[model samples]
Target: MYEDFASTLAATMWTDFDETPEREGPTAEITDIDSFVIDGNFPWTIITLETDQGVTGIGEAYPSPGVHEIVTDYLRPVLVGENPLDVERLYNLMRESLSGRGSQWGVGTIAISGVEIALWDAAGKILDQPIYQLLGGKTRDEVRVYADCHAGEAMVSSAEEGQEETTYEPEAYARAARLAVEDGFDAVKFDLDVPSGRDIDTLSRHFDPPEIEHKRSVVEAVTEEVGDDAEVAVDLHWNFSPETAERLCEAIEPYDLAWVEDPLPPENTDAMRELKRSTNVTLLTGENRYGRHGFRDLIEEQAVDFLAPDVPKTGGIAETKKIADMAEAYYQALIPHNIGSPVATVATAHVGATVPNFVALEYHAREVPWWDDLVARDDPLIQNGRLTVPDGPGLGIELDWDVVDEHRKTRS
Candidate 1:
């Protein structure tokens, strides 16, 4: 039965394979693509592509409004009936087809990213190879992960109407760091851009002296709490002005942070470069950016010490691997910014495993209890502070659809 399916698929999909030397083996045509929105800590957008050969591949898009529509309405037309095995070719096709419809950046690229990941996943399953192996093999067996403990249980997004206000005290930050360290993560991060009780003007994006001191105190507390047990990093969330960012960097420099992330907004690479010049603390950015073109200036201008491209947002696996390659040429490390489900996390890990410059992958769902339950695995995907790269075909993990349906949200 399997041989019959493969032969039928190849006959229908690879009529031109004999004419092209580079094309070989059986090909599976994508029959349908679907997406689901799970209401987890964040709205996790999961994608699946069905193939003619009875294979289905799963992927995750960076969560955003209208991602489901973008995937089904826009991208589905371009993907159905195409060869899923032609990963890069299909990726470029999607980009070129959406040229003016915001494919270069924003949610359009994000939707395409999810579909592209599905393509890779389907391709891997068809070829009976893991994604890392298809990406040229692994550099390490395990990928290091950093827990994004957002300012002592304070949600990165705004609090609910009836929820208690999140405290921005140093003690809270310290306790958060301690808990993460106790959980076996050797690297942890907290938000430094939280309410400092001394904000003169947040809309102006300026940090007054008192606010700077408050942020510095929080950093000191976390660093002191973790000590040698873990490396501490803080996120500025692109919330401050360049001058204020410089002051904040200067204040935290004494603690020897792993990296201070996104001090300034994503628009100005020149400002980021100047901020890098002004601070001794390691700077990390690129989560807001997309694709190699989006990250070109950051890499070429030497803007930051580390690049944190969100895999599901920045053109999926192949595109991110290309970005890492570009960053590698300039000696910058890849520490991907991930706020995704286990699907996106494991997909990003595949890229992390293959890249020579991968430093660590960000884990943002520590606060979500059912994060590990979303995947069908006996053991947790992440053990201690590291995730062992899966050697099984494709992503090496499957979604627990029962959990997904339980948490699934209605599309708006």
Candidate 2:
């Protein structure tokens, strides 16, 4: 009896050790596209791709006007009957289709981002792997997150009366950074490029001495308040002309920013290349850029210190990774531009984990108190300025239907 029991135990050990779960092959066709417009301060255009095999995938595109129309009117017809697992092929086909409208840069790309992201989610689910696993596995267990703290009053509707207003004064900025630090975040970003203490014109590129001083003081206060506890970065929102941008970059150099983001608009790569040559300070941009092709010149020209692709805005998971791959070849850091809810944050993190030259990912949902509550997870999605890549299948977390049902917007 003892011999038989030992033999059985040994067999069980061998069975457990010798085999692992394998992903299912592509077999299901995409059946339908269901979407929602979660309108609040900013709209979240969420898409759900359904497969015939009872599997579904969730994805998000960055907030923009008329994304709903773009998705339903253009992309749905292309995706409905295709093999849900043919992610990259579908991505290319969509690009081809949109060539008539415009090249991959604006609302068309944003619409494709949502659809392509859903394909990855569907692929992950069909393969029984996390999105990161499908992307050739991750280099790290967690992706570092930076809080995108804003200074201006949020464009909240009158319905959101309970929501708080945020300001951009030196003291207020300091306090906001401290709050982020206390909440287990090691990095914080603030928008320092607002019409404050100055009036401006596009005809002439100039900033007043007091306005420049006010911006300088804002950075000083934040850096001082955070001290050695957390790193600081600031956004200029592509608000300045090249000449004015260089002056601002020089003025803010002493604060040791993680980056000074998008000082000039992304209209010209030659201009960005010139700006990079002028600053030893880490300059980052690319949230407005489309696919890998769109970012090619920026990387090849050594235009910026770091690349900041908004994964959901750029071209979804696969294209964003392709952009990072190019940036890695040039030895640059990738700080993904994130302004959506948890869906985009986690999707971007999956890509961040796979990239060799990733720096940090942005987290801009700080203003929405109930942002974390939208998804069902055992623990908080972000802690101590990093998010542990989820281990489950697909995006690894499901949208809480109850939460989405409460805040969904109705179109007239």
Candidate 3:
């Protein structure tokens, strides 16, 4: 099925190089390619590359419409005849091709992310090694995973095991926290900004008094409910001003929350730094950051205590590792924001295995019942709320084609 699809987009991507005898040697030329946009928690654009040697590597770009065109129209022509094992060389092409045109963020990074990851996957297979070995080696047998359980989604609030619905009361948060705790997760994150009805309305400079109290209740409920069983974190999603964020951070300081994520939008690091100074709460940020260059200042200034780059969105394996390494130098942890499918999750895990500063990878699809079915595995991919880094090869997971086709979005 993949071969047939690859044959169509790949016919021209694979330029016949019989004329260029000097350019020969160990080239695992790309033979076929296909991309899928599956509608899940977010629109996930997944890419697959088939080599002349019958090795098909899977990769994913963070959700973007331009990724399809970039992969097919821009990158295919340059990458088809190139050696898949020349991971660094191919990655340079992905970057330099758009150098003068600015390929650091948006569609540029997303496109490069897909191509760069596929190159690494192919390189791992050709070397007969796990992706982690290719990156360096394992730092841990399993990567700790944190569940993003919140009341904004269907959850277990009552005795009925399968019951699920969105409710944002303090008790609702407590129920969600208990649900995550019972499932063997020792670390949990909750969306604290949305529960207060006044948040979106009072966007100017500060939160109303009632709003502050409501937000505090949500945090305390989750922390009190989970107690010592699990460490708790809250995500602001950049919905607060520095003044408001400062107050909120001070309010939640006594609860012992793991960190306050993106209390304000990252447009101004100075403001974020001020927020950092204002609170005792650890700051975790940069899920929307694109590449290593985008993270340099964040790491250099020590604006945040943890860097959470979404794997697929933050330039895939190499770039994310670079960002993680940068954060490590500043004694910051790289937790990695993730809302992607199994492919991206495991790809991030291989990275999690290598980075010394890796804290825990996020598992955000607790509500998607078919999330596990997307991968071909006999046992569960996630065990006790942690993902055991697979030694198989590449990302160490295969997409369940039947399941993907069913949820695939028609546009891409």
lDDT of 2 at 67: 74
Candidate 3's TM-score reads 0.90
TM-score for each model: 0.92, 0.89, 0.90
* Best-to-worst lDDT order: 1, 2, 3
After superposition, candidate 1 runs with Cα above 4 Å error: 1-24, 152-166
Q: Order the candidate numbers by TM-score, best to worst.
A: 1, 3, 2
Clashes of each: 0, 0, 1
lDDT for each residue of candidate 2 in 123-204, tens digit (9 for 90 to 100): 8888899999889998999999988877766422211355443455687778778888888889888887775644566446
User: Could you list the CA RMSD of all candidates, in the order they appear?
Assistant: 5.7, 11.9, 4.7
lDDT of 1 at 383: 91
Per-candidate local distance difference test: 0.86, 0.81, 0.80
Count residue pairs with overlapping backbones in model 2. Answer: 0
lDDT of 1: 0.86
Best of the candidates, lDDT? 1
